[model samples]
Target: MLELLSFGDQGWGDEMLLAGLMTILVSLSSVCLGLLIGVILASFKLSKSRILKLIAEVYTTVVRGVPELLVIYLLFFGGSSAVMYFAKMFGYDGYIELNAFTIGTFAVGAISGAYSTEVIRGAILAVPKGQFEVGETLGMSKFQMNLRIIFPQVARLALPGIGNVWQITLKDTSLISVTALVEIMRQAKVAAASEHEPFVFYTTAIVLYLLITTGSNKFFNRAEKKFSKGFVIEEST
Candidate 1:
């Protein structure tokens, strides 16, 4: 069984490595896109306008309420059709094809964004109201205030929650196997089916995922520590 995973023409080592890399790439892309969406959602929720707040709330609630597998299926089947319909409206007769990778990233991002919206909004609200008041009193523009004062603190407070979301996004990419993107889990499935050794291949895949998650956790921990430096309190009893 071990020899089957060896790096050779007879082995699947290279394929597995490539698949693992693709999984990481997809996860990273999805997380970045999700963060962008989350920021927009958080802003909308925080806005004074009732209409915008309602829209944002509805988006988060609906997305979070739905199953992730359903979301992936919707994007996989519907996204291409929707794009083609839009293209027809623009007088383009060509089909604008979105590959599995694109669909997987977008689907996972939408789900991650729903969770991230709440995390970000809570983080933003955790910042004392006095901070915003001070920024206003200093005559800081809204953008300047957010950039200089609000965003940094929110990032620090939101890191742990975002870290959890990142892990979920990474694991969620496994579901993209349904769309045939050939990420780690898909590759493992293929190998298992071909070799007729489901336990060996699946076990290896699980170990590989554990390794990736362990490394990612370390990075997040380092980031948290770096950002938390100088703010660590030494409690005097």
Candidate 2:
């Protein structure tokens, strides 16, 4: 077991470490993209246009309805073809390729965005209508209001939900192995298969994942506290 974790060519410790970092990088990028896309979708849902609202609703519904594995498969195969076609349109299609990193990030982001749309929309709705009136009375522009008032409250309200999304995104990264992205789970599987020590490699992978989840929980807790400070809530006896 110890030999399997050693730094020599026989061991996969370094590969697993690098894969863990790649997992983190993919998840982070996915979360960022998801947040942006979710915000846009949420805004569209909240918009006055019926067409825009329907479009956003259909997007979230379709995405959430499908299995995540299918989403990754679709993106992995279709994304490359789409890129190549676009390159051809520009008269430069010599096998336009997207790296595994891009594919993994986007596939996870697409899934994350579906969930994040609900979280953000609910958070936005939680804000009091009176706040918007107050902003209007203060001569605040829509952008200014969102920047100064709505965004902070949405961040606070969405933090817990977003944390859940982060956890899901992290776990979903395991699916990226199909795209040939060498994440921790893939590395562990390879090591276990090669070394015939499934227990050792799998156990190590679980511990590493647990460590990441625990550390992320701590950061989320700190953020929650920072945001909730100075706001008093009535406790029911």
The clash numbers for all candidates, in the given order, read 0, 0
TM-scores for every candidate against the unseen true structure? 0.95, 0.94
Best-performing candidate as measured by TM-score: 1
Clashing residue pairs found in predicted model 1: none
Q: Write the per-residue lDDT of candidate 2 for residues 92-211, one digit (tens) a residue.
A: 959878999999999999999989999999999999999999899999999999899889999998998999999999999999988888888888988889888999988888988888
Model 1: per-residue Cα lDDT over 1-237, one tens digit each: 887798878998888888999999999999999999999999999999999999999999999999999999999999999989988999999868899999999999999999899999999998999999989999999999999999999999899889999999999999999999999999999999999988988988998899999999999989988998888733559
Name the lDDT value of residue 46 in candidate 2.
96
Question: Could you tell me how far off, in angstroms, the CA of residue 9 lies in candidate 2 after the best superposition?
Answer: 3.3
